[model samples]
Target: MHAITKTKPVPFLDLSAQYKSLEAEWLAAIRETGARGSFILGPNTQALEKEFAEYVGVKHAIAVANGTDSLFLSLRALGVGKGDEVVTTPFTFFASAETIDMAGATPVFADILPGSLCLDPASVRARITAKTKAIVTVHIFGYPTEMGEIMEIAKKHKLAVVEDCAQSFGALHNGKVVGSIGDTGSFSFYPTKVLGCYGDGGMVTTHSDAVDERIRRLRNHGAVKPFVHTEIGMNSRLDEVQAAVLRIKLRHIKDDIAGRQKVAQEYTQRLAGSPVKTPSLPKNGTHVFNLYTIRVPKRDAVRQALTDAQIGTSQCYPQGLHLQEVYKHLGYKPGSLPACEHATTETLSLPIYPGMPLDHIERVCEVLLEAVRG
Candidate 1:
């Protein structure tokens, strides 16, 4: 294969470059944490929680171990449990549904809107039953779902609305941030997210004091006092080191999100009139540009061609959750949810992070267009 060499290289994520940019500041924060000798549930963790709560426009924000735990804790705080059904989209990351299970509830699958790739509110209405206790609408790929209608539907049904903001930390819906609109919102700080820490981190945001109390107590083993347990809870507290790193990055989040928005605009401009279908923005929401995904007819073939050309591409979800073997007992056959199935087969995620330059994105787009034409 010495005869075949790539003209360009593209990676799905360049975490190393991002880290390098903040190496000096990150190392200083880490050394300071070590010097302080307070690694868990300390000053940095508390400060991060306060700052994050204010940023999300919520009354309280509780730091958790990771995104899945954030969802599980939110469901638990809302008093969802065994035999209860939580309506959610089957077209998102598995963590959205997995957390429902972790909260001891059954996950009810719903179809997502075709254009926006978020929960279809009308479909959600049809899925509601007496057993339905809550709705977990995932803001997939950092694009906010239409929340105004979804919130109205939830209110009519007397169901709690949990915004799965794991992919949308800074996204907005109708001039308001996503995490602040729902009954509660969950976020993930995985290394690849728009606003991420050096290690795993998560947050739960809410306006209700009662719900906040539940999450606070639950993350700390259900104890109101030290060594005294009231209810059963799990160990899901954020570490001080991750909180420190997140605090440093949080100050620059607006700038980071602005950079991403600029890149997304460039992609939209360049990809216009192409055969591949580009993602559309919702009427009432601001997309944070977590992943710039598009739908194409020959998705698999184009993906392979990109890989051959040293251009990285990702398939967000190859199979819908309802069609997965784990949920076979739900009795959802292949054709039952046609929209979700179709999306799974055709959707492809492209790299669109803040660290890359405009010329790099243009090069990626050219490679992508060429691959599709072949």
Candidate 2:
């Protein structure tokens, strides 16, 4: 018999740690922005857009207020509206589908692949109808969705594709990055994201010139000139202060992503004998380790045991969107998405940051292994 030792509590994510390491750079950028008094879609914001576009390997990147707006604008610019259906995964944040509904389109739920926990190409093909206008393939937990397969499916059906890359900023699929593969790539720079800023910010990426033009106009009240409106739009511009910080962070993203990948490797090696399902390996470069999630028996019990041990944990998405109360009008039943429903019950995300300490990861695994044993 072994007596497992407990240590200090680990934070689910350490945003403060990351900030402290880059304090000098962050402060410098803030000072520069303040000195210029150029806020709100200024030079910093424009420069960030260019850097991000190049990072994602896309022709255009439009900075927006938040992730939801990034998706909403993508759908609107791609001509998704009333009487149209957008096929998307059921096991993810509600915002993925909510943005579709907000664009006045019907949200069609699709099952996920058991291994990837991402939208299944077969399920997507089954769900497409004559009225299906687009597909919003969400790269959940930073694993790039099966884009090549999905892209082929889209081409056969002539459907537009929006890569909801909220959690997959630097992740790549095949030889290409995520946002560049789809017609439009939507990103969220929420504080906890892999490339997050101090506050909320987002960007939309695309290869088409016309789509880029529409999003630029739609983000600022559909006006070609100041105080002159061509159509209806919203105020969803990324501010200069956030952009400045992002520019600094963007420079270090490659190394940060490498750190995350190393952490994931340690986790996979440590949890070798545990009777839990670890994340599947990604196809290209790596999964980027945005969230190092696993599936275990009695998941809720395991989570409780970890909590009692002063270790942080999280169930990324406890309930599928198709089964939520708000989506009742969609008329989906319990078995609507089997793979998605299965994930909702078992997925558990552990503490993972770019530079997460090895001792902390060991403690997390020890607690998790013990809980699953019982």
lDDT of model number 2 = 0.91
Error of 1 at 263 (Å): 1.8
Candidate that scores best on lDDT: 2
Against the true structure, what is every candidate's RMSD?
Answer: 2.7, 1.7
Worst 10 residues of 2 by lDDT: 1-10
What local lDDT does model 2 show for residue 216?
95
* TM-score result, candidate 1: 0.97
**What is the RMSD of candidate 1?**
2.7
Candidate 2 lDDT tens digits, 1-374? 23445658888988777889889988888898899999999999999999999989989999999999999999999999999999999888888999999999999999998878889999999999999999999998889998889999999999999999998888888878888998999999998888899899999999999999999999999988899988899999999999999998999999888988898888899899779889998766458778899998899999999999998888978999998999998899998898888888899999888888888888888888889998
* Candidate 2 stretches greater than 4 Å from native: 1-7
Which 10 consecutive residues of model 1 have the lowest summed lDDT? 1-10
Deviating ranges (above 4 Å) for candidate 1: 1-6
Best candidate, TM-score: 2
lDDT of each: 0.89, 0.91
Clashes of 1: 0
